[model samples]
Target: MSKKMGLGKGLQALIPSYEDENKKTLRNITVADIKPNPKQPRQEMDKQKLQELADSIKEHGVVQPIVVREVPDGGYQLIAGERRWRACQLVNMDTIPAVVTEYTNIQAAEVALIENLQRENLNPLEEAVAYQSLINEFGLTQEELSKRVGKSRSYVANMLRLLALPDDVLALLSSGQISNGHARALLALDTDEKKIVAANEIIKKQLSVRETEKLVKELLQNKENRKKKNERAPEMEDLKDQLQGVFGTKVQIKTNSKGTGKLEIEFYNDDDLSRILEILLDDNSHVSRETN
Candidate 1:
C-alpha cells in the first residue's frame, strides 16, 4: 500500500459492522478476555491522544469491533484494532465485539503495522517506533521495510533515524514545540549541548528551517575553526596528510603560534608536484583551505 494511505486513510470507507450483512451484533466481550499481542508494533499511545479518542468514543459508539486472535488462555489477543479498543475503553465499554483470527506472531505484527500505516493513523513518533519495532522484532532491513511499505529506502532510513534523537528533542517533536525540519537542523549538531543551544536559538529567533540550516552550518564552521586554533596549524597538518597521500612522499608542516603557519609541501621535486596538484585540483575542483 502507498504510504499516503496510512492506517486512517480509508478507515471510514472500510466495511464497518454497520455495513456488513453478516456482521456480528454489538456485543460486550470481557476486557480481561482480551489479550495484547506480543507481536504488536504499537505498544504505547500518548495519554492526551488516548483521552481525546475516548471522548470521541463517548459521543459516538464504537463504529468497529477489534480484530483478535483466540488464545488458549481463554482471552483473545489483539490483532489489528488497537485504536478501536482504546477508544472503547475510554467510554467504559466492558465488552467489545471482536473477530478472532489465527495468525502467527510475525504475520500478526506485519498486518497490524501495515493496517495502521495504510490508515495514516500513527503520528511520527508512533510511526518511527513502529518501524523500529518491525525491524527489531522481525529482523527487517530498511530496504525490506521500504519494499513492504511502498516508500523509498532513504525515507525509511531517515524516519528510523529520528529515534536516534535525544529525549528532550523527541519530546519537543511529540509536543509540537518543534517541526521535523527544526529537528533535522538539530541533528546536524554533533553534541547535545550545541544542539540544545541551536534549538533555543530557533525558538527565540523564530528561524525557519532553511535559516536554521544556514545557522547550524555557520556554527559548525566556527566550531571547526576553534578546534583548529586550539591545535595550532591544523590546516597545514591536514594538508600534509592529503599531500602525502597524493605524492607518496612524507610531507611535513612547520608553524609558529605568532599568527603564522607554513605548509611544507615536501615533494620529490617536479614530478611529485604534478601529482600533488592533480590531487589537489581534480576535474576543475577548487579545494580551498581556511583557518576560520
Candidate 2:
C-alpha cells in the first residue's frame, strides 16, 4: 500500500521545488495542450461560473499552476486545476502556469478527484460525480472513498445514487433549478415522465420540499387516478382565475376529496373589505352572505 503523504509532503509533491519566493515558473502551457481526464466524473461545468472565474483570472493572473502529467501520447493530461485552465481560456491566454510530471492513469485520476474534493466550493452534484468516479474508475469502495473525502460511507453512497436520476432532473439539479430536497422527493417516482412532471409542478407551484414529498406520495398512491383526473386541472384552476378576475385581487381556493372546498378572499385593509362588501350588496343575490 502506498502511504499517504501529509499536507506539507502533498504540497511538495505538486510543487516540487520552491526557488526564489518571487520567482515562480510561469511559461509554455497552452489551454489546448491540457487534456481533461476521460475518467473525470464531473461531466457538467457551469458556463456562467467559468466566465466569472475567467473574469477573476483577468484581474489577477492565475495564482496557482495546475498540476499535470505528460501523456505518452505527446500531450499533457490534467491531474488537477481544470477550473484554473477554464479561467485561463476565458481570458484567451496562450500560456498558463502548470506543473508537469509523469504519472500512471490511476495516479492522475486519483490526484484530480482528491484535489477537487478537498476544495470546498464544489456543488453537491460535482461531489457526487467525483465520488462515483472514484468508485467506478479507481476501484475504490464506498468506505475507502468516504475516508479519502472525510465523509461517511452513507453520505458517499447517497450522493452516488443521485446520478441515477434522469438526465433532465440531473440537469435541473446541476443548474440549481431545484433544491436537493426537491430532487430527492422527485426521485421516489418510478418513471422518467413522472419525475419530470413532478419537477415541473414543484417549480411552477413553488412547492416546499416537504410539500413536494407529500405530493409525490399522494401521486404515487393515486397514480391511476391521476390519469383520469384533468392533467392541467383547467376547471379547478379556472375557478380561482375567475374569482380573482371578478374580485380584482388575489383569491385562494382549496378543495378536499369530497369536492367540498373553502374560498378565501383577500383584502389589503378596511377600504378593500368595504369595496368587496359594496360589490356583494350591489349584486342583489338571493343568498345572504355573512361578514365580520
Leading candidate by TM-score: 1
In angstroms, the error of model 2 at 66 is: 1.2
Give the worst 10-residue stretch by lDDT in candidate 2. 2-11
For model 1, residues 1-292, the per-residue Cα lDDT tens digits are 2122232233332223444556553346776677776665554567888788788778876666777766776877887778778777667778777755555665567667777777666666667887888888789988877766667888888888778778877777776677778887778789887887888788889899999999999999888776767776556667777666655778676655345666666567788788777766777654445656
For residues 14-33, could you state the per-residue lDDT of candidate 2 as single tens digits? 34444645535444687888
TM-score of 1: 0.62
lDDT comparing candidate 1 with the true structure: 0.70
Name the weakest run of 10 consecutive residues (lDDT summed) in model 1.
Answer: 1-10
Query: RMSD in Å for candidate 1, one decimal?
Result: 12.0
lDDT of each: 0.70, 0.74
Give me the overall lDDT of model 2. Answer: 0.74
Candidate 1 residue spans exceeding 4 A from truth: 1-28, 37-60, 227-292
What would the C-alpha RMSD of candidate 2 be, to one decimal place?
13.7
The best candidate by lDDT is: 2
